[model samples]
Target: MEKLQAAQLKKVLKPIHLWAIAVGLVISGEYFGWNFGWAVSGTIGFLIATLVITLMYITFIFSYTELTTSIPHAGGAFAYAYRAMGPFGGLIAGYATLVDFLFATPAIGFALGSYLHFLYPQIAVIPAALVFNVAFILLNISGVKESATFSVFITLLAVGELLLFMGIVGPHFKLDNFMTSPMPFGWAGVFAALPFAVWFYLAIEGVAMVAEEVKDPKRNIPRGYISSLATLIFLALGVMILTGGITDWRKLSAIDYPLPEAISIVLGKSSALTQIFASIGLFGLIASFHGTILAGSRQVYAMARSGYLPGKLAQVNTRFKTPHWALVFGGLISFAALFTGTTSQIIILSVLGAIVMYMMSMISLFILRVKEPRMERPFTAPFYPVFPAIALLISSICLVAIVYYNVQISLIFFAGLAIVTLIFVILGKHKVQILIHTD
Candidate 1:
C-alpha cells in the first residue's frame, strides 16, 4: 500500500506532446549557440560538421528509440545504462545526463535574457535570465499535463517563428558572403566545431526522459522521435545556411542574438517588424528552457528514487503528482551555472555531457540486445548493429576531437566526472540495490 501510494506522474502525454517536447527541447540551437561553430570552423567547415552531427542524431534517435520504448522510464539514458551495465553504469549515465540538462538550462536562460536585452536594451541580461529560470521551475512543478499543453502551444509558436525567419531572411542571402573564409583553419576546424554542431540537436533524446508519461509509449515514442528529428534537421540546416549568407557571417558568429541581429542587418535595426520578430524569438528559448527543466527534474527524480541521492529529492507533490523537490533542486544548480561562464562555454560543457551519455546509451542498447534477447521490444532499431555502430563511431570521433581542441574544457569535464565517481564509490552507492521500475 505504501509503495502504491507514493506519488507518481500521470500518463497524460500523447504523440503531439512528445513531439512538442522533443523539438522544443532542441529548437533553441537553431536560434543561437550554433553560430559559434562558424567562429571556429567557418561556414563550409561548420556545414560539414553540422552534416556529420546530423547523421549521428539520425542513427542515434532510431537506435535510442528501442531502448526508450522497451524501457519506458523517466531516467532516459540512466535507466537504459543501469539496466544494461548495473549500478555503476547507471550512476555515470545519470551524472552525465544531469550535467547535460542542468548546464543546458542556464545556457538557454542566458539566451532568453540576451534576447530580452536585444529587444529592450535597458532590461539587463543576467537578471532577466534568472527570472526566466525561476518562472519555468515553478511552471514545471505545477503538473505534467498542464506543462505538456503549454509546451505544445509554445513549441508551435517557436516552430512558426523559425519558418517565418527563414522566409524573411531567404531573399537577402548572398552566396559570396557565406563562402568567404569558408575553411579558415582547414579540416581541423570541422573537428573543433563538432560540439556546436551537436548543439543543433543536443537534447532531442530528452524525449526519452518523458517516456513514462506518454500514452502508449511503444507506439508514440518512435513517432515523436522520428518526426521531431526530421523537423529539426530541416530547420537547423535552413537557418544556419540562410543566416550565414546575409552578412559577413563572421560578425554573427560570436553573438548570442545572432538570428535577430542578422534580421536587423537585413531589415534595419529600428524596423518595427525586426522588433516583433526579436520578441517572437523568445518563444524558441522559452520552449527549450521549459523542456530542459522538465527533463532535468525527471533525471534527478529517477536517481533519487533509486537511492543514488537523498530520498527526499524524489518526493513528488501530492496534488500535482510532479517531482516538485527535484525541480527545485535542479533549478538551484542551474542558477549557480548562470554565473559560471559564457553561453559558448556552457554549451561546450553541456554537449560534452550529452556525448558521454549518448555513448553510454549506445553501449546499453548493444548490451541489452545480448543480455535479454527474449525481452519484448515493441520497437526495434532498424538495421540493428550497423545503425548503433555508426552512432558510436561518430560520437567517439567527435569526443576525441572536442577534447583535443578544447583541452581546458575537456579537463574540467573529466575532473568533474572523476570527482562524482569518487564520491559515488566512497558512498558505497554501487552496492546499494537500485530498483527503477521501467513500467
Candidate 2:
C-alpha cells in the first residue's frame, strides 16, 4: 500500500462513477447467464438460490467496504489479505481476482458476439467477440476517466433496458407459469443452481479493485457499493421473475438471449421493437466486458507493483496513466479463452475464483480486526462479526457446491492456481519485497 511509482492512475472517479463501474461489472449477469439456472433447477429452485446468494452479497459488500475504505488499494481483496494473512494470502487473492475478471471478459465478449449475430446473422460469433474484446482493451488503455465515462453511459442504457424489459414483460405474469415444475430435481436442483445464482451479482466486488482511484474512498466507496447492490437486487429479481412468466422457463433457459426471446414471445418475433430491444441488449454485455477489462488490469498492475508479477506490467502509460501492459496481457488471456472454453465453463471458472476470494476477504477482515486494532476504519461493517461471518459461511458453502457440481472445471482452475503458487514460491519474491500496510 505504499505510494505507487512516478506514474499512477488518476483519482477522478466519484460515487456516481463507482456505481457505474460496480453495476456495469455485473450487469451482464442480468442479461444472460442467470437463466441457465432454470435449465438445472427450474424457475422456483433458481429463485431460491438467487435469494440465498443475494443475501451473501448483501452481507459481503457491507463488510467488504470496510476493507476498501480502510486500505483503499488498487489490489482489492489481495491488499486486505496481504495485510492480514501475509504474502501467501496475497498471492491467493491476486490469482483468484485475475481469474475472476480475465475469464469474465471473454464470457461477456462471447455474449456480445452471440448478441450481435442474433441481431445480424451475417456476422459470425467468435470473430465478433474477438473484435469487441480488442476494442475494449484499447479503450481501457486510453485512460480511466474515459473508461468510467463509458461505464456510466453504457450502464445507464443497460439498466434502462432491463427496466423496460421488466415493464413490458410484467403484464404476462402468471403464478402458474413460474410454478411450472418449479423444482425438476427437488433440492438437488437448488444446489446445482448456486453458480447461476452467484452470476446475478458476481463481479460487483470489482468496485473495490478501483478503490485507489475514487475521489473520496471513505464516503464514496460505501455509497457506490450499497447503492449498486440495491439496484442489482431489484433488477435481478424483477428480470428473473418477469421473464420466467413470459414463456416456458425451459425455452429461455438454454438460450444466450433470454430477455429478447421473452420479448419476442410476449410481443412477436417479427416486431420491430423486439429487434431494437435485442440490439440494445449489447449495451449490457459491453458494460461488463469493458468494466472487467478496466478493473482486472489494475490487479495485474498492483500485483506487479508489489513484485508478485513482472514489474513491466506495473508500468502506467506516461501519457494516459493507464496500465497499458496489464491491459494487453489480460486481453491476450481473454482472447485465448474466447477460443477455448464454452461460456458456462468460463463462468464456472470465474465464479470459483470469486467464491475463493470472497472467503479470503472475509477471513482478512476478521484477522485485521485483531491484528491492527486501531486502524482508521472510516466505515465500520455494521453488526461486526455477524455480517462477515455470514458472508464467509455462505461463500464457503457455495464454493463447495460449485466444486462438487463442476468437478472437471474446478480441477482445471485449482491446477492452474497450484502451478502459479509454485512459481511464486520458487521466485522467492515474497522474501525480497514485503507489502506494507497503510494502516
Candidate 3:
C-alpha cells in the first residue's frame, strides 16, 4: 500500500461527508444567538435584511470554493497567502485564522453551557457546560475521523430539530405577529440584527480549512460548501420566520433563548413536550459547539505547521495522529470564556472574528487569482472576479456596518488582534519560518 502524502489526504473525504461537516458549521452558533439579535433589532425589516445577508454568504461560498480547490491544502486562508503573498501575508492570515478558531471555540463552548442550563435548570451552567466541552475536546484529540463522525451525528440531530421546530411551530404563524413593528428602534432594529444574523452564517468558510482531510476535495469541497449554505439558509429562514410569527415578536425578543420560548408558547408552557423539546434544543447547541471546536483547532494546527503561527501548535499526536497541542489550546480558551462573559458577549465576539476573517480570506481570493493564475485549479469558481468581488464588497460593507453600529466593541476587538500581531513581531517570534515539505 502506498503511504498517503499530506495532499493526497483529500482523497478520503467524499462530497457527502464534506457536506455534513459544512452543515454542522452553519447550524450550531446561530441556533441560540439569533434571538438576541432579533430582540435588539425588530422583526419586520430585520427578516428582509437577513435574507439579503444570506445572499452575501452564498457569494462567499462560491469564492471560497474556487480558492480551496486551487490550493486544496490544510492551511486554508493561511495556505492561500503562503503560496501567493509570502510569509508575512501568510502570518497575518494565519493569525486571523487562529483568532477565528480561538474565539469561536469558546463562544460555542459557553453557548453549549448556557443551553444546557435550559435542560437542567437547577445545575450550574458553567460546570455542566464545561463537562460537555471537555468531552468534545478529548474526542477531537483522539482523531479527525472521530470528530467528523460525531459532527455527522450532531448535524443530523440539528437538522431534525430545525424540521421539528418548523413542523410543530409553523402553524402558529400569525399575520398580526409579523405585520407590525415589534421593536421601538424601527430601521435601527434591522441594522442591529446584522451582527447576529452574520453570526448564524459564520461557519460556512470553516469547511475550507478541512479541505486537506476530505476525499476528492476538488469535487467534494465545492459541493460541501454550497450544500451546507443552502441548508442553513433554509433553516435560518424557517427559524426567523417561524419564531417571528409563532410568538409575539416583542415577547420573543425579551427572552434570552427566544427559540425555546417561542416553542414553549406553541407547545404550551411547562408541558412534557416542552421538556423534551428543550433537551433536543440543548443537543443542537452541543452539536454546534463541538463542530466549532473541532474545525477551529484543525485550522490552528494547520497554520502553525505552515509557520504562520507558533510551530509548537504543529505537533501531531504520535499515538492519535491528531493535533493535540492545538486542541488543548482551543479548549483552554473556550474554558476561560465560560468564566468572563454572557452568552451574548461570546456570540458577538465570535461574529466579530468571523467578519474580519472573511474579509481577509475574500481579499486573498483576488490576490491569489492575480498572483498565481496558473496554479492548478481542480475546481474554479463559476464567475472568478465577479463572485469573489461581490463577496469582498459585501464582507467589507458588513465590516463597516459592524463598526458603525458597534464601534466601541469592534475597535476593542481589532485592537486586541493588532496588539497580538505586534507582540509576535517585537518578540522576534514570528520571523522564524517552518518549511513544510510538500511535493
Candidate 4:
C-alpha cells in the first residue's frame, strides 16, 4: 500500500575487520561439532569428506566474491539471485541464508554454554546459552563497528589458542591413533559425514552479507574472503589431525567441546593447564556466536527491507544505526533452537541450508555471466565458469549425500522451506513489488 524505504547500514568495516568477521563466524567449527563426523566416518573418511568440502569452499568463495563485489549489497546471495533469476530465486537464497546463520548461532551458543559448564560444574547449559544469545544481541544492536571490533579481538585470541593447541598436541600425535577405525562404515561413511565436514567452514561465506558495511567492498571483500579461507583451511586440517591423533576419536566424537577434551588428554584432566585452556578456548565459540548473530541480523534486515518478511524487521535503530528488531528476533529463535536440539543436530541443519544456498549462488554466477556480460565486475573470479561449475557440482553432491544419509533432518529442512514458500506465495508476492520501487 505504501512505499518502504530500505534502511541503510553503517559502513565501518575495513578489509581486516571483514576478514575477522568472516573467520570469526566459522572458527568455532575448529573447536567442536566436526568430531561428530568421526562417529559416522572415522578420521580418514571424514578427512576425505572435509577435503572435498574444502575444495567446494575455495571455489565457492572465489566465485561468490565476484557477486559480492559486483553487487555490493547486504543481501549477499539473495541479492545475486534476485538480479540473476528473479523473485523465486531470491526467496530461496534469502530463506536458506537465514536458516544457515540462525541455526549456526545457536549451535555456537550451546558450545559456549558447554564450555562454561565444563569450567563451573554448577552452571547449566540452557541458562548459559540464553545469556550468550541475549548478550551478543545487545552488543550487536549497540553499533556495527563495536561488534566488529569485538569480533576481531576475540578472533585473534581464538587463532592463538588454536596454535597453542597444535603445539601441545603435535608431539603426541600418533599416526596409529589417527588411522584407527579410519573408515569404520566404509565408503558410505564418507557420504554420511558430509554434513559434519561442511561444518568446518559453514558460515565463512557470510562475509558477503556485510558487503554494505564494508569500505571499498570490491577490493576488501575479495581480500577478506580469500585470506579467511586460507586461514581456515590450515586451521581445520591441523585441528583435525592433532586432536584425532591425540586420543580415541570416539571420546570426542559426540561432544560439543571436542578441543578441550582433546587438550585434557594431553595436559591431564586435573591439570590447571587443561582448565586454563578450556576456559580460554571459549573465545573461539564466542567469536563465531557473536559474528553469526551479526550476519543473521543483516540477512533478516535485508529480506524484510526488500519485502520478503515483515517490514518492521528492517527498521534500524535511530541512535545506533543497527537492526535492533532483527537482532532480537534472531536471538529469540536461536534460544528456542538451543533448548530443542543438540549441537550436532543444529549443525547438520545449518549445513543443509548452507549447501542449498551455495548451489543457488553458483547457479546465479553462471546465469549472470551469460546474461549480463557487460556488467562491471571489479573483481572477477579466477578461471570463470570452471570454479563456479566445480562449486555447483560439489554442492549438489553434498546436498544429495546429506538427504540420503540424514533423512529425518532433510525432511524437517524441506518442510520448513515448504512453509516459508507457502507464506511467500500468499503474502510475499505483493510485497516483492516494494523491492522494485525501492531499488
Backbone clash numbers for all candidates listed? 0, 0, 5, 0
All models, RMSD in angstroms: 1.6, 1.4, 3.3, 1.7
TM-score of each candidate structure, all chains considered together: 0.98, 0.98, 0.92, 0.97
Instruction: Give the poorly placed runs of model 1, Cα more than 4 Å off.
Output: 1-6
In model 2, the runs with Cα more than 4 Å from the true position are: 1-6, 437-439
* Reference-based lDDT, each prediction: 0.92, 0.90, 0.72, 0.90
Q: The CA-based lDDT of model 4 is what?
A: 0.90
Instruction: Please identify model 4 stretches exceeding 4 Å from their true place.
Output: 1-4, 428-431, 434-439
Which residue pairs collide in model 2, if any?
none
User: Which scores higher on lDDT, 3 or 4?
Assistant: 4
For model 2, what is the error of residue 183's alpha carbon versus the real structure, in angstroms, after optimal superposition? 0.4
Q: How does residue 187 of candidate 4 score in lDDT? A: 90
CA lDDT of 388 in candidate 3? 74
* lDDT of model 1, residue 282: 96
Better of 2 and 4 by TM-score: 2
